[model samples]
Every structure is written in structure tokens, then in C-alpha cells.
Target: MRARLELFASIRRDARIEGLSIRGLAKRYQVGRDTVRQALSDPVPPARKTPVRSSPRLDPFKPAIDAMLVEDTTAPRKQRHTARRILARLIEEHDALELSYSTVRDYVRVRRAQIDVEAGRRVEVFVPQEHAPGAEAEVDFGEVWIVLDGVKTKCHMFIFRLSHSGKAIHRVYPTQAQEAFLEGHIEAFNEIGGVPVKHIRYDNLTSAVRTVVFGQGRNRVENDRWVLFRSFYGFDSFYCQPGIAGAHEKGGVEGEVGWFRRNRLTPMPVAKSLEELNDRIRYREAEDDQRRFDGRIRTIGHDFAAERPFLAPLPAEEFDPGLVLNPRVDRSSMITVRMVKYSVPARFIGRRVRVSLRASELVVFDGRAVAARHQRIVAKGGQSVQLDHYLEVLKTKPGALPGSTALARARASGSFTSAHEAFWAASRRVNGDAEGTRELIDVLLLHRSMDAADIQAGITAALRVGAVSADVVAVEARRHATTSAAEGGPRSDRHRGAHAQAKVQRVVSLTQRRLMDPAAVIAGLPSDSRPLPSVRAYDELLAKRAEHPAKTASKENIS
Candidate 1:
């Protein structure tokens, strides 16, 4: 009976046999049914024996097939056909006539075991751990829903955890913009009261990974701006590959991310505003610091307190998350920043203005004083502030001009209209010439000062006359000069005769000088020389000589 167990084992091991029935085996051995049945049913034990000959079908290409199978198991099943295809290619191309499809399949199965063993041994080699307080931290972002302005809005959750102490900080933001990301870091650092010396590990979010280079050990990171931000804040970043498999490295923050959303934001929390919602999240986060973990003696706050000493001291100046953009004011005295137009004083036209843009508000300054302020509007290409905003100041001191260049630009841009031109023209009339034109322009600018009516009238008068010339305007003014004598004004009739006699004497003197020296007379020489006798004076002297004719006759007789 014991020998029968060996016989049954031999039969089972034979390649030609499959299952050996008890009845069939009994008939073959010429034994009683019970005896044969017992022998057939008995489990076969292995005897120490020499190894059988290995299959020749699988022997030759075993190593190559095993390598293929090992690599295929990690790949998709559709790709496993590559193994069968390669086997077929070997037969066709290399005259491998003995290798059939079934033989190749069995060989591949056998080789797979050996390949798996090799692959299992070749895993990532991890270094032994040496944990230090505040040496490392993990960071990640999650999403949460909270009531904002009476409406529920989804927001991003930023979570960070100290690897050694298990201390954690969490914050929520309306957006995941880069500014918000950096700001969240700054706030987290402040809450922890220090910075971590070891690298901060995070999943490959766009803020960290600029591009992923396939097969390379490292990918290109964000621009220098982010690098400088990290350097300035005294921390380093370690970005994991961008998938669930790579996220295990940052498990600390990953757990914290879900924990924050579930514990703080769930159950439809309500808030008056986004800021209020953030305030509530902040309060909950602070409260969370007091909680203890399983088997830990200290609370998260206590762990953080102990870890604070190991962290680097915070820098003096806080990080500025605002973007600095340079924009030039167009001819319209308006600058476009982030799609919104802000008007500076017209004087700033054509000059470049620097914009320190934040998420919620825009503040414009000229040197130091706030030149303009506006609520940030997200739309593109529209004025955020009106030109009329600074109109009063421009009117008060027209000489404090943005200059003719700015005014001309404003006019060209339709900011200054035909009405403004009319007012300017009237002012020119009141002033006369280019000088008057300039003064009239100053008056029209009084769009801030004198009544618009008065300015318009002045401009109309100035244009009607070609008082376009200041000199012509002066002459017109003299012709229109009024005298007071006709009314209750000064009486000039009494002095008229004296004025007439003085005028005649001046004419007589001028005529005598002209006859004496015509060229010098034209030159208007001074009357220092003796005056010539008048024609009337010569006639009088001749008459007197004739009266003395009798005496002359007597003198001639004596001669």
C-alpha cells in the first residue's frame, strides 16, 4: 500500500496523464476497489530525486523572454502582445523553426517568475531617518466652500505642517493666484512664529513647476521671482511630481488639507463677506493648535512652541505680494493698468507711472501724495476714474499747467470740446494778441473758476474781431475808450483855448525850422539856433523905411 502512493505519484507526474480515477487505477493494478481507491486518494509525498531535464523549448530564449515579461507586467496588458510579436519575429527573421506560439507562451510564464524576483529587489533605496525639530515641513492646497457676501463660494485651502513637531497652520483664500500663494506662506510663517530649515515639500502645482521635462531627474521651476521670494523668506521648496502617486511625500499637509476643509468649512458655514469667512477660518485654525494627537503628550501649539527655537528668525521687512507694473499715461492723461484706466493729473500725461497692483484695489501716487484711487475692476479697456475728478484743481491755478501739450492732447482726445474752444476764444478777445489768447485760454480753463457763461462770451468776442492779433486788439481798445466829460465827468472846454494856442505856437515854430534846414527839419533838430524873421515882420520894416523916404532923399543929395 505504501508503494502504491509512489506509483500514483508517478502516474500523476506523467506528461501523458491528467486525473487518474480510483476505479480505473484499481482495474489496472488488479486490486480490490477499496484498496486501490485508498492508494489513489492518498496525497503524494516528494522523495529526494535528481532534477529532470529542463524544457528545450524554453531553454534557449529564457533570459530574453524573462526580461520582456518583467518589463511588460508594469506596462499595460495591450502592450504584452509585444512579447508574442517578438517571438514570431524571431521565427520569421532568424530561422527559429522549433519555437511555436504555445512554447513561447509557456516559456514566458516561467521566466516571469524570475523576472519578478529581480524587479522586486530593485526598489528605491531610502536613507535612514534622522528627525530634527523644525527641520522639514509639507505644504499643499485643497478646496472648501464657505458663505461669502451671503452667497456660498468655493475657496482654496492652504495647509502646512511641521514634520517633526506635527504643528500645522491652515488658511483659506478666494483665489489661488500666485500673490495669494506667497501671501499664504507669509501668514503661515507668522502663525508658526518661525521658518523651517529643511525643504518644504509640495505637489507640482503650477506655482512651483514651470515645465516638466520627461525622463529627467528634475523639472524647470518657476521664474526667479518665486525663487527670490523663497530666498528672501528663508526657506526652500521641494516639488513632487504632479499626481496622486507622487503626493505621498507631502502626506503631512495632504492630511491637514482635508482635515481643515472637513472640520472648519463643512456644515454650510455662513459669513457676511469673504473677509469675514477668512476671519472665521483663521480663528478655527488657531483653535486647532490647542488640540493633541493620539499618543502625543503635547498639543500642536506646544510642539510648535518647542520647534520655534530651531526655526530661522523672520526677516525685518514683510514680503510684498503686490505686482509692480509700469504703465505710461496715454495722451488722455489716463494710464491703463490691468485693463482698468486710471486718470492722473493731466500734467502726468505721456509720463510713465508705476502701478503697485493688489487684488482688490488700485492706488496711484504722484511722487508721494495719492494722485488717484479706485476699486479694482476686472474688465478690460475702460476708464476707472474720470477726468473731471481733478478738474477743480486744474482750474484754480491755470498756470500750474500740464502745459499746452497736455491741453492739446486733451482737446484732441475729445476731453476738451468745441465749447471749451469757444470759451478760450472769448478770453483771447478780453486779453488781445497771442498774450491775450494765452490769458483767454487761462480764463477758459476757469471752467473751474468764472461762470462757463462768462468764459463762453469772452471767447465769442475774441473770435469775432480778428483780435486774433494782440496788437490789433490794443488799437481797438483805444478807439473804444470812453471820456467822462459828456456825463458828470471832467470839464475840458476851459482848457481848450489854451490847448489850441499852445498847439498853433508849436506849429509856427516847426514850419520856420523846416524852411531854415529842410533835411535837419525832417530830422527834427532842436531849436537852439536864432529864429528867422517872419514875412509879416519884413513887410512892417519896409513900410517904416518908406516913411523915412524923405530922409533918404536928403542923404542921396549930400552924396
Candidate 2:
């Protein structure tokens, strides 16, 4: 480059000083006449252009490949042919043995871009953007799997990220339903403390967009509920073009979802429930607030601290982030929601009940009061039941209690503890199977009004005195419940009572209990409504019979 520049400079300087002709300059510089003319005409040479290399062998098949690529415009994306497939077709169909896969691939790459640009379809380009504070945000959903209660379950992760600050919040839900979609926005808005001042960007998600007016234009027919939600929150929605072509529109959240899933949620989290898993994701979001994005001076938290004041103030009234459904409770005391069965109280059977279904739970309402609340079951055909919901049905059909789905779930959940089992066993030994189970069912009924710990304590109290009666257990349970109420209902010593026998093993005398607690021993439990039981009255009758025996013998002799 330097040598060429010096030659051009010397030729130009000499030509001007000596007034040399092109021939003289060419002779003096020992170069061609054209080169001397080129140096004289311009100080810098134009870039060299590569000559077009002809491929006569493959040239005939170029039209075929172009035709296939044109055909690909209308083909389903995943089913479209690759370069290798094109080359294989050329070899098989047209007998073009000269073409290699590399030749076809290189040509295909350049042609694909050219074709896209020519059609004004997927012309890939992005102008660097400067985002205004609180002006824009991005929302996206990514698939994530979590071990929910030991079952490997697939879940949807909704991410809302501020475009300027890069601050993001994520939540996991069983489905990407409209309720979850709207609920995610509400949660993110509340967490971020306000809504974006301008518009939030989104892909053409079905939850928001009912139809995309397919063209270069950004026209969309949105969901009615979504439109109302936007009106209520006072924010605008920006719909990106659909598919991979539009992924860049919401690139902030798109990249965030992938980055977070890899960095934080990589080792697929294990949780007992959807709520527990979401709690984990929520904490991770807070930690991300302190993160500094690449090439930025301010941390995400710092940028957001400045950006927050610019955001629009939240609405005074909150939006209801649940979908209302009126599902009729089946004869099984269960309602089918999204094809999943959830047991309501037996009283609601054969009636349509209002259910407010949220992302994580469903609350069944009878009138206005909640009849039953259960974690939303995600899996189709899955059933979730509360034992308390079916206790009434079990009363008349005591035999059904042993085989009922509610009982199985109760036992699995550790709600129906071993204490209940021990009491049931003792009762069966004292009475017969049918009668004993009926008594056990009565004891189970105490769980509705009494605390589980109090009920367990009552069961333990009855078993200690060899009182294998539901009546005795009820009396004892109420006593424990009243005592707990008097002592401010502290449950520092509370447990599942799985080891009901453990309490019986370490029996404390009444004197010892009085010594342990300095509080008045006379104030054991608030007075019972039932009369105190007395076997002493029966003993007194026996003494009277013994005294009257001689008198009764004298009366018989007189008769």
C-alpha cells in the first residue's frame, strides 16, 4: 500500500512539475500507460473486483434450486428443504453430478438473503436503539420444567423486563392460559411498582391477540379481556410480528428468559407445589436487580431506581386476575375444571358452583363464601380432593371411608395422622369393625372446628385413659382446644401426631403437670357443657343392695 501510494505521488508531482506526457510518465515509472493514466486520474485506486467464475456443470441446476427456494416461501418452516436436500435432488432428479453440497450450501446462503430482501420478507437488520426510562418493556413466555411434588412437570415461565433498566420479574405457571398471562402482568406491575409509561412489547401471543392482520402492517385484533385490562391499567400494547421473524422485537425479555433459565433455573428446581417453585423464581428476580448488564455503568437496580419515578402511577383499584367458571359438581363431589377434577364439599354436589380460577389455585364459592379451595391441578384427568369436603358423605357410608379417594389423599398428605389410625384400631378391638369405624368417622368430624394439633391431642388424651370411644375423644379434644384458646393458642409444641404412642409412653401425672406449669391448676379447661361422668353413683347403689338383702329375705318369708 505504501509503495503504491509513493508511486502515485511521485508520478503526480513529476507530471505537474515537468509537464510530462503519459508516455513519458509510463517510461519514467516503468509502468503501463493505463497504470500511469490511473495514477494521474485518481490519488487512490478503486478496490479490485473478483471476476465472475462460471460453473457450466452446475449452472443448469441453479434454476432448479432457485425454483425450490421459491417454493419454500409457502412451505411449512420446519419441513422446508436444506442445501444438502437440494444438492441430493439435483444429483438424483436432474443428474447434475458436478455439484457438491458445499457449492449448493454457499449459493443457497447468499440466494436466501437476496430472496428475502427482494421479497421484503425477512430482511434481517436491526438499528441500535436507545430506550427511554419507563417508556417500554417486553413480555415473553418460555417453557421450563420443574419437579412438582416428585412428578416431572412442564410449566410456562412468564417474564416481564424493563427495556431501559433490564430489571425483570419471572413467574411459573402450569399453563400459559389467559388468566396466567394477565395475572403475570399484574404481578410484574406491582413488583416493579408501576406500569411502563408507553407501550409494552409482545409477540402475537394468542392470549392477547385474537388475530394478526397478516401483512407488513402491525395490525392486530386483540382479546377483549386483554383490551379491557389494558384500559384498566392505562398502558398500550405493541404486538411484534409473529414467529422467529418477530423475536427481535421483544429481544430484551427473550434473552432474559433464556439467560435466567440457564444461569438460575438450570438444574431443574424441585418443589412441593407450583407456589413453592414460584417463590424460588421470585427471589431470583430480586437477586437479578443487582446485576449489571454488559457495557452499562449503572447496575440494573440503580438504573431502575432512577427509572421508577418516570413510570405511570398504578391504578387505585386492583384488577381481578382470575377467570370465573361455573362448573357443576359431579355426583363424586368433584367439579371438572380444564378437564381436571377438584373435590368440593359434598353439599355442593349436583349444583353449579362459581369457581374463580387463578394461575396457582381455584377457589370454589357457594353463594359468596368459599366452599373449598384447592391448588390448581395442572395435569389433565388429575384429581385433587380435601378429606374434609367429603366427611358428610362418609358419615352415612362408613364403609366407604376406608376405600374413598379422599381418605387415600388425606393419608398421603399426612393430614390423617397415625394417631387417628391408632385410635381407630383400639376402637375396633373394643367394639366391632362397623361400629368402631363409625366412631372413628365421628372423631374425624372434629377436624372441621378444631385445630389439627388440638384434635391430635384429644385423641392422645382418650387413648391414654383406655377410652376407646368417639364421645371420650370429643370431650378430651374440646378440653385441649379450650386450654389452647386460654393460653393464646400458641402451638410451640405442635406436631403431626404421627407418633401418638410417644405421648402415651411418657405419661405425666396431674401433680407433675401442675408443678411444670405455675399457672393455676384449677383453671385446667373452661367448664365443659356436658355433666361430669360418675361411676361412684353405681357403687353407692351396690352398697344399698347389700344392706337391703337381709330385709328382703324377711319379706320373702312373710309372703
Candidate 3:
């Protein structure tokens, strides 16, 4: 094409500029006179035209093929007639049409694509919506595969996007359960500082929708708890149609999930923990605030700031986003919550307790008293046992203390510091292993009332004095705790016994030391021996030199 255009251009230029005859230009360019005459008439190269051929047999059946292709758009995909079937129909049903299968196949291939293009152009189209600030929002959940802490893990990301500003809040969760769904809404609302006034659009997520009535326009049964949540926030909901077809209703957040994942979470985020991942997400969101979306004149942060005042004010109190469960504590003192088991007090075993499960923590309540609280474990079948909950059981089964989950957790949390370990080892050397472990459990029980550091420090103090008894550890812990309280500030309640006298004596001793000068105290110390005086030989030499300056200068000059 390039060579042909160049030849044509050169022929035209020579003919027009040099005023050469067609025959002359043909001879110069080594081409025929007709080619040169054509180039001279048209400055641009002529496009090659496809030769038209008469296919007398297939031409008559072209209308039937076009109609079949057009109707296939509304027909079931599998039921649509194939090219071979269409050919058979053309010969058998329409006797007048006479064409071979090969000829029909070649013609139908090009014609079918044309029909599809026409059908697509005639398909349903959406009108662009103009949303008001703080009046509309969209909520959706998207799946993201992230490498969390070196492990390739799949997680659900909840995306909440304000339609007007294109501002979005995204959070990752291990599961798209009802609890996480509700919690995501709570957090997103708090972050946005208000709720959308008109309607927050959502898909037919099972967390929010109990049932969807087919053929009913936006008429669906919503979840009870979800209804309450929506009522509390004072926002109406517009549920999109179910499945892929309904995705466009909440398109803002749907696109946001992909946009955010590609821009911020791409290249795979590696973090030590989920909390660390969330912290990174927070920083990414802050960075995103400065960026403007395509076709938008203002940045998201700027638009959100202007829209914030128009949003509905928050309710007086936050909604409780915890899902309530009543799981019976097993003989092992563990209650299952979301497939993960957490240990409560031993006394709760064989009984049902109320488990309030939030996204991050699970609180177990025995009637009015809180039995246990554990950081919610995301992994299934994982156990989170508090040693304090099993102390009573450990007291009876000292042999089990060596491999108990409670003990491991205590060590990991530094609640059972090395001081406790040292005390236990010394106790074992003196009182034997089982007895020592039992004694250690007794000291661990003290953590329920006193601070772990105070108890550990006391254990250290007791061990320094070569005492291994739990009683000695208790006394040391109490003594230091009391001293810490007294030294912090003035005593709230004055003691009137020997203990009070000792505290008063210590205070007086500290005051007297502060009042005494260091120099006087050093002078009061007894000397081992008296030092000898040194001679003033250097001073006498200086006096003689000062008296004979002129004589010494003359003597030095003669030498």
C-alpha cells in the first residue's frame, strides 16, 4: 500500500508540477500510460474494490438467513439453529432455495456478525444519573486475593462509595458473614460521619435480603436485623435485581472495589497481621484523598468536604453490630462461635452461655457477669483459651499444666513472664515438678486481682532472697504494689499500725537525706591518713627570673 501510494503521489506531482504528458510520465516511471493517467486524474491512490459476483442460489435465501440471525438474539442460546441446520432448513423447508452447505456456511458467517451488531445497538441502555451530594451511596462486597503475612489468602472486601463525590471506604474481612456485613456498614458510616439521606443502593446480598420476589419490582423480604440497622441509620434502601444483572444498581462500589484493589492492593500487600494490613489500607485511603477521578473537576476529599454538611446527622448512639449466639460450653470449657472455639470459665461447662460475637472480639456472658472475652479467631476450628478461665481445672489437674493451651497463651502474651518461669523452676527443684506447677498456678491466680508485672516483680524479689514459696511471692508482690501506690502521690487513707510507722520512717529518712549537703557528709567521713605538703620550688624559680630579666637577656645573647 505504501509503495503504490508513493508511486501515485510521485506521478501526480510530476504530471502537475513538471506539466508532463501521461505518455511521458509512464515512460519515466516504467509504467503503462493508463496507470499514469489514473494517478493524474486522482491525487489520492484509489482503494481496491471487491469484485461483485452473482451467487444465484444463495442470493435468494439471504433474507431468510438474516431473519434467523436476528431472531436468535431473543432465542435460548442452545436452542438457536446452527449453520448446518439453517442450510438443511433452507433446502428442505424452502424448496426454491438451492445452495450447498459450504456456500451457505461462508455467507452466514459474515451475515450473522452483522445481525449481532444490529441487535447490540438496539439492546437496553442506561441513562447517566446525576447524584446529589450526601443523598445517595452504594454498598457492595467484592472478593480480593491478597498475600497476607506471606500466605496467599482470599478475603472479602466491603466497599462503600458515596455516589456524588466518588469517595469510598473499603475494609477487608475473612468472611462475608452477617456480622461482618453489619459491622462494615457501622464502620463505614462512622468514617463517613453521616448517612446518605435518600437511599443507599445494595445488591440482593443474603446478609440484607431474606428473599427476592421474581417479577416483583424492587419488592423483596429483607433481613430482620438488617431492617433494624437501616431503621437506626434513618436511610432507605434500594435493592438491585439479583445476580450479575443487578450489579449495575450499586455500580459505584462495584467499580471501586476493582479500582482500589488495582491501585492500592496490587503487587500483593505483605503484612505481619491483619491489623497491619488494615493500617496500610488506612494510609492508602488518605493518599487516595488527594486524587481526582476522571471527568471530575474536584478531588474526592474536596467534594466530600462540601457534601459532608448536607449528610444526615448521626444517631445518638451506635448500633450494636454483634451477632448473638447461645452455644453450650463443652466439657473442655470451650464454646464454639463461628466454627472457632473459645474457652470460658470451667464452671460454665455443660451449660449454655450467651456469646456476643463482634467482628474482632467475642464476649461470653454467664447471665449478667461476663465470663470471658477473646479476640475473635478468623480460622475455623482454632481455639483461644484463657489460662485464667482454666485455673480452677488446672488446680485439680496439675499434670495437665505442661501442655495446656492456656499456659501457652499466657507465655506468648508475657502474662507469665520469665520471672514466673524462674520461680517455677526453683520451686520444682525444691518441691518436685507437680507440686511446683500447682504452686505456680496458685501464683497465676493472683493475676486475676493484681497486675501481672507487679506479681512478676514480686516473684523476682522473692527469688532474690532465695524464697520459692507462693506465700513469699504473694507478700513480695503486695509489698511492692503498696510501695508503688504510696510513692505515686499522697496516701488516700492513712495507716495507723506498724506498717504505717515503717512508711512514715522511710519518708523521714528520705527527707533527712535530701536536707543534708554532700560536701558536709564527705567531710564527716573518717580519713585513713594525712597527706604530706609539696615544696614551692617552681614559684621561687619564677621570682628569681622576674628580678634578673635584663641581665639574663644579655648573658643569653653573649652565649
Q: Which candidate is the best by lDDT?
A: 2
Best by TM-score: 2
Which ten contiguous residues of candidate 2 have the minimum total lDDT? Answer: 511-520
Q: How high is the lDDT of residue 173 in model 3?
A: 80
lDDT comparison, 1 vs 3, better candidate = 3
lDDT of 1 by residue, 331-415 (tens): 7677887667777767777788767665445677677676667655545775565444445455555553435445655665565
lDDT of each: 0.63, 0.83, 0.81
TM-scores of all predicted structures: 0.47, 0.70, 0.69
List, in order, the clash count of every candidate structure.
Answer: 9, 0, 0
Question: Which of candidates 2 and 3 reaches a greater lDDT?
Answer: 2
Q: What is the C-alpha RMSD of each candidate to the true structure, in Å?
A: 25.9, 10.1, 21.0
In Å, residue 412's CA in model 1 sits off its true spot by: 34
Ten contiguous residues with the weakest lDDT in model 1: 477-486
